[model samples]
Target chain A: MIEVEQLSKVYGSTAAIQEVTFAVEPGEILGFLGPNGAGKTTTMRILTGYLPATSGTAKIAGFDVHENSMAVRQRIGYLPETPPLYPDMTVEGFLHFVARIKGVVAGDRAKQVENALTRCNLLEKRQVLIRKLSKGFKQRVGIAQAIVHDPPVIILDEPTVGLDPRQIIDVRNLIKSLAGDHTIILSTHILPEVSMTCSRVAIINRGRVVATNTPEQLMAELAGETGYELEVEGDIALAQARLAALPGVKTVEPIVDSVEGSGEPSRQKLRLSLVTGTDPGREIAAVVVNSGLGLYEMRRTRVSLEKVFLELTTEEKAIDPETMAAAYERASHRDTEPPILPISVTTDQTTDWAPDRTQSIKSDETPIEDETEASITAEQPSRPEEEP
Target chain B: MQSVQILFANLMAIYRRELQSYFASPFAYVIAGVFWLLSGFFFVAILLGPEGLIAQANFRDQLGMTNPPIDVAAQFVSFFLGTLSSLALFILPVLSMGLYAEERKRGTLELLATSPLTNWIVALGKLLGALTFFVTLLLPMLIYQTIALSAANPPAPFTGLLLGHLGLILLAAAVLSLGMFVSSLTDSTILAAILTFALVLFLWVVDLVGNSLVGPVGAGLKHISLIRNYTNFAQGVFDSSSLVVFLSYVMLGLFLTAQSIEAFRFQRS
Candidate 1:
């Protein structure tokens, strides 16, 4: 129902989005997945005819967005990030006003407004002024206004940003039900929303589409190697050697096991992770049994959609050590130093928290790279910061 | 014909919404109340105070001097219309400041820009909405005129009163349209109000600058001066050129406002 090609928007010298290309089939929901400042809203704005692209073209129902904007707008419904509401207007009044401007026929206006109110579960609050409603209800009213005219395409920007978990689920289900009648392009930074709600996911980073596929396809394509975690009571060195000696085994690493409080000395478990190109669960189990090691448990792990998203979005150019050191210095100076405790008093607590802290820091570095790279590129033209 | 009908439908939709929003807020009531109070005070004090125009005319009659008729109706209506014109310089900016500025601040401009309605329709709707409310504010002043004229020996000329009001409405339409243009340029209503007041005040006094200049330059400045054109109408004279000038100002303001909104839409896109 929507086609966008080579869509570029440049404000002065800085490009808000460059050469963005995507399509949504009729009755399909496409999740525009990206972190903040990833140009998702810019693309949606262009597609909905809310903005004009500096170059390239967008079409809805075969009408060019720029040249035939009225026709394109007639076919599309847009809910901007802020919901575009008048606080003094009641929910029903606001919907009626939107319907009139959206060109719903006068005879059907009441029916259409009622339908929207019911769809958004806003019937009870139809008479209440929008300013008196809670945030979640206001968001529902926003969605109601967009859908009141029954447009064929709906563009929503971060439809569930501030909602509680239950409200999020309710909104997700509402969006799911909207499919098959309306083509949806929803942009959000939240990862699982895409996995759960979208028929297809497009991952954008640095104003570029890095990956586009179904959630399952993305996970499968990135899940090239399999891993297994095993808990066993044995001579650690012998088990490591045997696991590494297996044909498909790539690497073997022992994990720090918290088996201190176990009563049985024979059950002093050692946890190990085995990375292999193929399943090594069976081979490792046989090896552990034949080698006289106690095998307590084994499980296989596959790549998740979150990992695929991270890998695609975090493929940043390596930073030089000087810049890294400067960044670290800036960070440490900004954060207060921990109080100096006696060596013995701090040793055990430090050891317990050190691994988790390092792991978290390592995880945080990827997104920070994406953010800094985006900001540096955006600021290169020395323009005022434009919110996406 | 079909396109025109669609355009009218769109315009009415926007016009109704804007008009409804005005009544929905307390700002409109406060503005109207202050306007009525001030205009009512000027009307009563200038024409009916203890040392007023009628009282001085009575004193002249008591002195046994045969002075020709003072034309009390003409004098009072002229002065009353002038007061309204000057008051509009301040009242209009307050009324028109929120026409587009508040919509921009609240993000509703996005909805309007992306909708199927043309920029001209939106601008015209808002202008008409503000103009209609301004007319309502002028209604109570007519009651004051009725009471004052009933007590006078020679009543006001009904044609002159109607003609003067027509001039007031035209002048107001011109000023409100320009104020709407200024409102479209900013997101802050206060800034819109201040800028509009400055622009209107400049045009209101531009004839003074014209007085110092000589020859055709002075004539041209006098011709374009808003107050100069309005003064002819205040005197119950229907000069065709003055009508043309006020109409041109209204059209110019409307055209500029439409263009401003279109430019803003492009910049956002």
Candidate 2:
């Protein structure tokens, strides 16, 4: 439902976003991840029709942002990084004004306002001036304004920015509850926000999208050597040698045995960690049992989204200010190359060890036409499988 | 129809907010209270005191100056009315400072900008709200003027009376419109108020400075002076040129206010 093609924005010496292209299909939540000043706000501003892209164009639900801004605005509800508010006005007064300007029907406006206030848990504060509210409450009021119109596409810029942890969870849960009915472009640099809420994650750095995939796919693709941390009772040297000798066992190392939690005084458990080119967990288990070594427990540890995001973005972080600005401008407008790289992870001789049942291969089969609506909270009756 | 609807909607919003602010704060009460008290003192001084207008044998002494008098009644009243025009030079900026300045400062202006309404609707709405508040000060003064005119020995110049009040209303509208336009240029109400006062006061005195000139250059300057245009109305002559001039000023200020808001759309992008 949204297509951004080679959108780029250039300010005299800096590019806010660079040649960034990404799409959102109906009923999908796309996480817009980036560091501070990484063109996340700039990109959202362009999509929300708040700013003109220096060069490229973005379309919302097939309506060109620049060419048909009013139409695009009508279809999108944007909660800017700062919740635009009038401190002097009461919550009810402010929402009433917003409803009028947003073109809510005269008869429906009261109902919409009441519903919005209730949804944000602001019904009682409706008569209280916004200035008297705490920061978290003000933020909720901001979210209330954006969603009061109930536009299909909701673009929230750092909705959780200043809220306390509990309030963050409150807003996060609110976003999740709305996800099924509204396509959301959740822009935030907070890594866990994406993993927890968004179905697809796009990592943007220095104004360009460096990578994007489901949280799980990103972890699986970037992963290199699989390792099993095992605790066993045996002669340490002999077990290590035996595990190394097994097929597909690339290397073996001893991990320090920290038994503080086990409370077994003077009892030692030998730890064997291995980088394996094969299904060494099963093979090594057989070898160890055959050798009469006690195998207590074994498990694989995977890299988290935080680790993957930092690694991919840091490599491209050395760009000059001029290039960085240009890239941000370009990325915001998506004016250069499509930042979309096919997340093609081919399971080669790797498929022989398919017991990692949590693995689901990502299909790059997503077409560009359906990006915007795909992430909405509304159910996509036409789409059979909305997941990537 | 679209423009009309937008204008009415924005006007209603701004008017309600501005009116609420006026009553909630002390600015309106202060402006009106101070003005009436001052005007009241001037009124009592003229008709009741020893060297009052009652004993002058004509309204000439009501002018309130001695030997080759400066017509201080008209002068003091003009100063009183000048205070009306001058208070406009001051109070208007404060009233208008919130028009677009607060909206932009708070970032709520985006809600208006993205709406289907054009900039002029919002501009006119704000202009009208401030003008409505301004009228409160002028209306009472007009009532006093009517009382003074009726109590006169031979009766006051009806033409001058009507013209003078009309001139005052237009001046308030013009000043408030200019102030609102200036407010739209920035997000800081303090800056908007300061700049607006400086600009309006300058325009008011431009005519005074021009009138002081004795040569051909002065004559040319007086024609463009804002005070000179209002002087004719004070004396009771309804000159079309002056009326047209005031209307043009009002329109020009509104036009620029609209343009100022329009410029934000580009700058913000």
Candidate 3:
């Protein structure tokens, strides 16, 4: 129901959103996931016809948001970050006013306003002045005003912002209930909101869309490459060398490097992140046994959605040539010395907290060549595989 | 025809909301109360005070010096309207200051801007709403003026009274329209009111500056002075040119307001 193509908004010298392209299918709730200042609000505003895009076009129900703004506006509902409410007016009065301007017929205006108030659980507060309502109620009134006309497309910018936990859940549920009939796009910095509420997620960072997919698919794509953690006694270097030699093993590093000077030099905790679809569990155990290492504990773990989000948003994928060469030298030199884990290697017991796994995996990558060459030669393997 | 109906419906919705807000606000009532107190005081003072028009006229009658045929009722109507218009000069700015600024302040401008209703439609609705409220402010004064004029020996001509009040309304509409434009330029109602006051004050007295100068430039300034045009109607002169100037101010204010809002859509901030 909505198509945004190469949309960009340049403010003086800074670009608020650059080449932002995303689409929401009919009846689908597309969660616009991004960190603060990630151009999510800018994109939402452009799509809602509230602000004119510097370039490109947004269309709702086949009408360009800029060229046919009135038609697009008639078809869409928008709730800005601050709920556009008249504080002096009652809840029902505000909704009726919204319905009128949104082009609801006079005969149906009261019914539609009532319908919105009921949907938002605001029936009890209909006669209450808006300024007298609580923050959550005001937010509900904001939502009611947006949906009063029963528009097909709804764009909300951080709709659940300032609400308490219960109110947030209520608003989220309200938004979810709105999904089947209205094509909904909600922008938020909250990660769990997207995973719980949106059917498909579009993760934007630094004015660019880094990835877009269903939440399950995004986590599954990152979790596809399984990781293993092990505690071993006896020559740690030898066991790591053997594991790194395995075809599918991607990186091998000491999990607890802070314990290096504290004792247990002979005993170490190590983690191995493998290439996609390659477990190598049996071979890994065999390698450790043959290397005369006492294998204490072996546990398999999967990447969570939080890790996928952090990887896509926070990882500095584009390494400068100097940092790359320095990282390459460090990687090659580490082969000779005892494996002190790179700072990027998260020391968490499981991969659940490994937000910087991409950096750590790249630094400890085997053969040294893939470490430097793969970054510049092709797309980073750690990048989230997004739909075209 | 259907489009016109929709437009009217939308306009009424906006207008009714604006009017309702004013009726609900204590601040608007305070403004009205102060206006009534001040205007009521001046109404009685102008008619019955020691140096008032009636006292001076009666004294003139005692002296038997009716040379210019002074019509006391006409004189009182014009003088009272002049005072009311001056009172309006202060009060109208406060009234119009919140027309768009308050919307911007409360963030409801986003709702109006994104809606299917056009910019000019919203501006016109707000103007009509504010103008209607201004009319209500005059209703009490209208009653007193009618009673006071009923005692005239040669009852005040209805046309002259209508024309004089019409002049006051036009002057008010002109001021409120311009104030609305100024209000749209800022989110701070205080700043909007101050700026509008500064603007209207200049237009009110431009003729003083115009009198000192000579040639077409001077004539042009005097011709455009709001008070000068208003005085023509207050004195019961139906000048089409003055009507055009008043209408132009109203149209100009509305047009400029629409343009200001349109430009706001593209503003980076």
Residue A5 alpha-carbon offset, candidate 1, angstroms: 1.0
Candidate 2 per-residue C-alpha lDDT over B1-269 given as tens digits, one digit per residue, 9 for 90 to 100: 97567557766765676666566566568867876686677666655556664556355656655677443335434544554555556677777777778888888777677654557766776777677777776777778766766665444456666667788777777777888888889889899889988887787777667778889777766765677788777766678888887888788988998887776766663
User: Candidate 2 chain B: worst 10 consecutive residues by lDDT?
Assistant: B70-79
Q: 1 or 2: which has the higher DockQ?
A: 1
Model 3 error, position B166 (Å):
1.0
Q: What is the C-alpha lDDT of each candidate?
A: 0.75, 0.68, 0.80
Q: Which 10 consecutive residues of model 2 chain A have the lowest summed lDDT?
A: A345-354
Clashes of each: 0, 61, 0
Chain B: TM-scores of all predictions? 0.95, 0.80, 0.98
Docking class of 1: medium
Pick the lDDT winner: 3
Question: Higher TM-score: candidate 1 or 3?
Answer: 3
TM-score of 3: 0.84
Error in Å for residue A241 of model 1: 16
Cα displacement (angstroms), candidate 2, residue B124, comes to 1.3
Give DockQ per model, in order: 0.62, 0.38, 0.77
Ten-residue stretch with the least lDDT total in model 3 chain A = A338-347
Please report the candidate that would top TM-score against the real structure: 3
Q: What residue runs in model 3 are displaced by over 4 Å at the alpha carbon?
A: A225-241, A252-272, A277-305, A308-388
Q: What does candidate 3's lDDT look like per residue over A258-325, in tens digits? A: 33323666778888877777778888888888888887667664433333343323223442434333
